[model samples]
Target: MAQMIVRNIEDSVKTGLKARASLHGWSMEEEVRHILREAVNQPPPARTKLGSRISGRFAGAGLLEPLPELHAQTIEPMVLGE
Candidate 1:
């Protein structure tokens, strides 16, 4: 049912795709279609960004030291809704 045409592909990339598809016993078209479908359907990896992933690895483990009293007091007023 696919009738749409794509344009402007480089020949070498297409050749590589065809070679890979043939190795898997699939036609280039079928392989491409499968790949497109998989790309759309698959969930992205659970963690992607470096900062969030690193933070997540140590989440709630009490590894970081608790704040000292004077520093905590200095910061607390800024956040407190008087």
Candidate 2:
């Protein structure tokens, strides 16, 4: 088993942890270990791009053509206070 040391925790956070541990009938140390174990055991969420997600959502809606990408448009800066 690996030992870990965490420092500089806020007083309020420590108090909260103690309360949570008491609620679950565990020591503060046991509560922290349980929390850490659960955190590490869960799988990470998928990272999908916004464009791909939109395409997937509307895939069956009969939009077969891909949109052309716009290129090199000149922008006129706004003139403030005539």
Candidate 3:
């Protein structure tokens, strides 16, 4: 088994970790080891593209009427310190 040392952690973080360990009924070191295991072994999120994901989400729903043609609108630029 390999051991690791983490140095210079902030007091607040240490306090939070200690509190979490107490909540889980484990010592701080054990809590840290468990946290590391969970962090490493978690599965990666889906890699689907944003457009495909959005389309797929509404695929089952009926399509709406065709959208009207959009007309371009101009916006006045912001004037600073007026």
- The candidate scoring highest on TM-score is 2
lDDT of 3 by residue, 30-65 (tens): 999999999999998889999789879988688876
Off by over 4 Å in 2: 52-68
**lDDT of each residue in 6-82, candidate 2, tens digit only:** 99999999999999999999999999998999999999889899999998999989978987787897778999999
TM-score of each: 0.51, 0.71, 0.56
Q: Give RMSD (Å) of candidate 2 vs. truth.
A: 3.7
Candidate 2, overall lDDT? 0.93
What ranges in model 3 sit over 4 Å off? 50-82
> Lowest lDDT 10-mer window, candidate 1?
68-77
RMSD of each: 8.7, 3.7, 5.6
Residue 14, candidate 3: alpha-carbon lDDT: 100
The alpha-carbon lDDT assigned to residue 45 of candidate 2 equals 85
Give the candidate order by descending lDDT.
Answer: 2, 3, 1
lDDT-wise, the better of 2 and 3 is 2
Taken over the whole model, the C-alpha lDDT of each candidate is 0.82, 0.93, 0.91
Per-residue alpha-carbon lDDT of candidate 1 for residues 1-82, written as tens digits (9 for 90 to 100) = 7576779989998999899899989899888888889999998977679977877888898878854456434443356676
